[model samples]
Target: MTNAEPPAPRTVVPIEPSLLIAEAFNQAQVTALRHSVTSCSHAAGLTGQRLDDFVLAVNELITNAVRHGGGQGRLRLWRRPGELICEVADHGQGISVRRLSERARPAPDTAGGWGLWLARELSDTMAVETGEAGTIVRITAALAAQPVTRPADS
Candidate 1:
């Protein structure tokens, strides 16, 4: 008998509009956008620290889009079995996503340059698409069951 490896999953495939939460936002509407993302994430079955990481990643992406993506952009969030997925897109001049991925690390104390880095760190898988048209960043993180909380000694 011959053994063969299964085909790899397509990480950059198009996301259907009805698959999950989808919204558009601009610089003026980030606060409300964050809330909506959190709600969608919760509904998609993420909790505990994994949920927190996903939330932070989306916040960074959306904030980056607002500040840099021509002052507006769109966000999409979805799920696939054990994974939670999110995508942030912007219609700006775009960037060298390759360079962004190669960066060693930005200073923690700096106020800027943390968006791409943070998203990569927080998610299990990250993909980037950029061009003269716009840029779309997709990230995926695995969902974990709730951890047991223990009482500390008083």
Candidate 2:
């Protein structure tokens, strides 16, 4: 047998907006999730601006799931170490980003292409996993006691 490395320890974090249920596609569910995240972050000492960023990224991911993932999905939000993480899962057709982008890149006239792109850009880290069970898009943003600063500040 060959030598194998042990798995790294998982990061433990506070779970606030845990396992949100989206029974049907609607504007209210999206709004509720956004508010829930921002409120949780703010209560945990995360500032308004930083909360806004988290909300934006989370909304984009969630919206994409509801709109593209057959009009329904599930979401989970938690704080991991120094970051806030949001995971949205859908039980519909999975996305193939490679083929979709290569076939016809969403242009200015496109409707929903910008959501995922914006989510990835706003969050510190973004990843997507799709399988027969569902598609889950994970987004993370660094939280700070104060508002986030631009890199140019240094």
Candidate 3:
């Protein structure tokens, strides 16, 4: 048999969900964007503390994009069954490995470095994809509280 070339590596792309809001933003638009996200998230069934936490998490992502990811970015918001999702993408240098790996609370004395950490803490789940070209952060919050299940004592 003739020598065969190795197969190309597969790239896994997440399927696009139906979008509720999609917009481009810059420093001047941060406030308006946050308001829009808040409205959309509320309409998607999040309420009270969950709504507030989700809005705060999204704000952090947007602010980070402005401050660290080149002053402008794109945002997308959507819903999937029981969860609401928001994604922010910016074209700037990628995040360092050290920053990505550190998930602890920042020291109270620290002046900055709270955005990503706060986003992670506030959302039900958070994911980031970054490289020299840009960075994308996606955060999800549940629309309703999930029940906690306990195992039977044997």
Best by TM-score: 3
lDDT of 2 by residue, 60-95 (tens): 877888777867777776765567777788886787
Clashing residue pairs, backbone N/CA/C < 3 A, model 2: none
The TM-score values for the models, in the order shown, are 0.77, 0.68, 0.83
Local accuracy by lDDT, each model: 0.83, 0.71, 0.94
Stretches of model 3 off by over 4 angstroms after superposition: 1-16, 145-154
In model 3, the worst 10-residue window by lDDT is 12-21
Across residues 107-149, which tens digit of lDDT does each residue of candidate 3 receive? 9999889999999999999999999999999999988755779
How far does residue 79 in candidate 1 sit from its true spot (Å)?
1.5
Question: Model 1 TM-score?
Answer: 0.77
Give candidate 1 regions above 4 Å deviation. 1-18, 145-154
> Candidate 1, residues 1-154: lDDT per residue as tens digits?
7788888987786645435777889977888888887887888777778778888998999998988888999888877767888899999888775656565678778888888888898888889898888889999988766567999989
With a 3 Å backbone cut-off (N, CA, C), the pairs that clash in candidate 3 are none
Clashes of each: 0, 0, 0
